[model samples]
Target: MKYGVYLRPKPERAISGDAYTIREAEGSVLLGLADGLGSGEEAARASRLAVACIEEHASLPLVEILQRCHFALRNTRGVVLGLLRVDLQAGQVRYAGVGNIGIYALTREPFHPISYNGIVGYRLPRVHEFVAPYHPGDLFVLYSDGVNGAFHGNEALLRTEEDPQEIAGTIARLYGRPDDDVSVLVAR
Candidate 1:
């Protein structure tokens, strides 16, 4: 399977504490987005550590990765994380999230956001899982909490186009607030 990824990290409130990464491997895509507690260098560090944890175990199961991160961040400031694992050949999408992660599968119609609860490194232990729908031309989009008030871009462009970076940039550029850090991932 082939894919594209685009990301733009910004420091909105003079602190800028968000980090993300999207990796496409042999059979799956490892996508992670995190918001480190508050703002400042500490926040950035938390976000970075969260993403690094996910990348380190990119080969593991979704639950295993989440569990590892949960343990690793126990002593840190913690972060809100969204993890997506896509099986290209199996035609499946797996979601395990803690905190503000807006995820969707856009086809001809847009659906409700996936149910996510808890905060990594925080006291919230709510962990939920969902199986996302994967279609031939369906686009999967995920964003951080800073993207709460995004413009969302054109569903048409997302469906007709295959470039995830452009789509992510368009969404970030148009929707991201000046006082916010926007990180996005688009997959089809």
Candidate 2:
């Protein structure tokens, strides 16, 4: 599978409040994104911390990593978290998330994955894992709220054969908000 990402800080802030990490194991890949509660350096710090935790424990279960993130982030500003793991050998995806990060699976059909309502580290709700069928060419998009939430499964965007980076960039440029830090990650 291939993956790509694009990010931009809120125009008004010196640093973006969003952070992300990607990890690949022997037969699976893991991706995570964190969005701090507000914009600026402090928020960036919080999100970075969350990403660091995710990267450090990529070998663990998604829920375990998130649970660890909750504990790791208790002292700082809280953040919204999203986690995705693709089992290449099994041709499936396992997903778990909290807060407003937008996630969508674009295959021959479009479907929105469930994200529980809560904030990581502050008020996390019960975490539930979701499993979905994945194919070689399936497109999965995970984005922060700074990017427009409405473009869940835009066919024009998902159907293109462009590189993942180009796809991420186009969406970030076209749908990102200037008042908030934005990030878009594309994976197959």
Candidate 3:
């Protein structure tokens, strides 16, 4: 799979409160994005903790992984997180998320997967896992709430962009808010 990531902090902040992880293990690709409850150091810590949990438990089931993240983040500021596991051998994608993180599938049949409303550590709603077939040329985009959700309208750019890095950079540059931490991850 080809993938790219872009991350930036609010203009006045020294570090972004957003964190992400991409890992390949046991015929699957694990992708995760976390936005801490707010910006700056504490938020960054929360997000980092979430991503670390994901990396440490990449082999677990989606729900289990998230559950671990929830337990691990209890003392922190909490975070909104999105997790996707692309099962290459099974030709399917399994995803679970909580809060405003957006996951967009730009494939022959495009669709947006739903995320439950809640924060990971503070108040987690019942988790639901969404599954979708993975095609050869499918593109998956995940971003934090700091990114403008309306950017999905640029399907042409998303579909045709050769470099995944360019796609991620463009989206963050055009749609990301300067007052919040921004993160975008693109994988195909």
Each model's lDDT comes to: 0.71, 0.88, 0.90
Per-residue alpha-carbon lDDT of candidate 3 for residues 95-125, written as tens digits (9 for 90 to 100): 8999999998886554558889999889988
TM-score of model number 3: 0.97
Worst 10 residues of 1 by lDDT: 1-10
lDDT of 1 by residue, 68-104 (tens): 8888888889888877777777867777777776776
**In the order shown, what is each candidate's alpha-carbon RMSD?**
2.8, 1.3, 1.0
Question: Candidate 2 — which residues are off by over 4 angstroms?
Answer: 108-111
Clash count, candidate 3? 0
lDDT of 2 by residue, 74-155 (tens): 9888899999999989978888999998887886544457888998889889998888777788888899999986675577
Better of 2 and 3 by TM-score: 3
On TM-score, the stronger of 1 and 3 is 3
**What's model 2's TM-score?**
0.95
lDDT of 3 at 70: 94
Candidate 2 clashing pairs? Answer: none
lDDT, residue 177, model 2: 87
Task: Name every residue pair that clashes in candidate 1.
Answer: none
